[model samples]
Target: MPKRILMDHDGAIDDLLSQLLVLTMPDAELIGVTVTPADCYIEPALESTYKLLQLMGKEEIPLGRGDYYGINAFPSEWRARPEIINALPMLINLPKSPDPYAYPSAPELIIDRLSAAKEKVTVLMTGPCSNLVLALEKAPELKGKIDEIVWMAGAFRTTGNVQTYQHDGSAEWNVFWDPVSSQKLVSYELPLTLIPLDVTNHVPVTKQFLSTLATQIDYKLSNLTGQLWALTLDTIPSYHYTYFMWDILATSYLAMPDYFTTELVKANVSTRPPNAGQTYLDDQGYVVKIATDVNTGYFYDYLLSQFKQ
Candidate 1:
């Protein structure tokens, strides 16, 4: 039986790539998709998501949005970067598709899906935790309907990639962008698995990998992925060893968990300014499974073979 999945994301290039990964999998039934305004304005994020669904011929899947903003201790620092706004940072080319139908509020859609699915739904989070937080707020009992939350969040035991807060340098982009929601969601004693920067940073996107992925992207929907991969790889300076395809690492773990090692620990998100979104161990925290190490070789091997050849 196919695993029923409901995905929530903030529109970004890597987020799109993560969606494509699930689309390529035969045993994963994408129940729905919800977009958050974390990376860009909700309008652009919606359009990008609709376009991808149309392009991939998955237009029938329900769409939803997480509307209420999470508290960002530092709003100015939380704004989207140029690369993130453009989505495809290095290229001006963007494919077009028909406009999508109106989507319901994410919380409502989530509750409806939870009530309908016979099997507990696997909620995939490639962005901030806003959508899940809202749904849980609206229907706290829905937690029991969820199988697990596979999230690409937190920095954990490593240095963060972005400095959303002050000079603390302790937050990953997803958690930093919306610290309040992150903290709220993580504190819950729900079933959750976190793929933090500690493991993702270890497996970087290299030229050779992109080249191989290029050969597998013959479908029209995947052409944009191929182009973005090519352009991003081309734009990298010679000195760079690998580019971190952040969200995909979490999605990769979803597709293959045997390639990962995890630790069950209690952690919390810092909601204070100059230290927002810093995930750290605290007595007042939630205990969840967090990936600490990865088998990069097997992960790369599995991911490479998954490209539609």
Candidate 2:
């Protein structure tokens, strides 16, 4: 049987790419998608997601809009990317207009879908844990229905990507957006596979790969995927070092676990001070399956193949 998967994202460029990745997984069925407002403004994110689904003929899949707000939000400039994605010709050309907010919000949607599911669902979260945490709170029994949570969060060994005010740059943006929520989710009993910056740092976006992808615009998927990355080119200096495959790496781990190395670790997220959202090994921390490394060459090959397919 194909694996039943549900996804939650914060609507970053990579997070949008990760959603496309989920659709291409041969052995998995994406049952639903929920958008957290952490890294994006809600409306444009939902509209862009809906447009993507429509373009791929996956519009029937349910979408949940997140109403929950995080403690520390992302920068306004970064949050504005979804609006640009929404305006893309590939996405905006779609027929149906998107309803930004679905009937059930994110937390409620999680409970509704999990309750109705026949098999255990793998929850792929590429953003903050706010919606999932709330869902677990409302229906603690939902934990039993979850096969595993493959999340793109935290940084155990390397420095984090967040360089904001009052932070020591020890936390990843997802966890740093809401450390308390992240900490709460870790305390749950559900199985979690954490793909942190420690491993994602190895999968930086390269000019060579972009050039190769640019030559394959005949495939609509590849073209759309390329356009998404193209938007980042001018703004991000030196993409090779500045940006890594963050959320997409986590999404890839679900479809191709053999391409990566993992280890069990007891870890906890700090919720206070300059070190807030920092993940550290603690005696009392929860045990999580942490991805330590990835086979970069094979990963790029697989990624290209998926886009072309």
Candidate 3:
């Protein structure tokens, strides 16, 4: 039987790319797509996710909207991006309709599906871990049912996306967005695999790949990815046409584990405000397998082949 996978993302370009990768693979069954709050608000993120699923021809897969904002937090500047603002209403207005899939809540749906499945379900998270944390809180019994959680967050032994003014780039966005939840999750005694920025930064989508894919996958997901890729390039200036395949790499690990180098070590999350989003590796008595490096050439080639197909 194909592996059953539940993916949660924040509708960033990389997340969309990652979903596409999972949809194209024959060995994995994408059970659902949950929209978490990060990089964009939950409303628009849900809309984008709906559109992407339509493009992939998987409208039957259930769609769940997660927390609009982090637990015990307010909206931030990151959620106010023009692109995000414009995408909000598109959720309700998307032309292609979704199946009549319904669930009481994201957490409830997660537990229900996992409980029903005979095989262990893999939970792939690529955004702030608010939904999973809530699921664990509400239904503690479901913890044992989970197979493994493949996460794309944090910066281990490297500079983070959110740097302190005092010359230390220690904090990353996803964990920083919800420090309380991050700290809570790290304590869970489950099989966890972290694909941090250290590995993702090495695998970037090049101009050649993007240009080729734009013409191949003629769908809304591809168009949105192309637009976001263009915007990311404009901001960086140097590598204007390429983007770090952050979330894509995490999903790739699920579909094809042979494409990366992994290390087993103890990992923990920092709870203090000053040290939030910090992932400590080799911590005493805590063993976790974290990905440190990736095979970029193989990843790029595989991605290109997927789009070509």
Question: Tens digit of lDDT per residue, candidate 3, span 105-215?
Answer: 566667677777788899998887888888889888888878899989878878777644332457666777787787778778578888888898897767876787688
What's the CA RMSD of model 2 in angstroms?
1.5
Candidate number of the best TM-score:
2
Return the lDDT, model 1, position 89.
29
Identify the runs in model 3 with alpha carbons over 4 angstroms from their true place. 71-104, 164-168, 212-228, 235-243
**Per-model C-alpha lDDT, please?**
0.75, 0.88, 0.71
Top candidate by lDDT? 2
Misplaced by over 4 Å in model 2 are 235-241
Clashing pairs in 3: 265-288, 266-286
Measured on C-alpha atoms, candidate 3 has an lDDT of 0.71
Model 2: number of backbone collisions: 0
**Candidate 1 collision pairs:** none
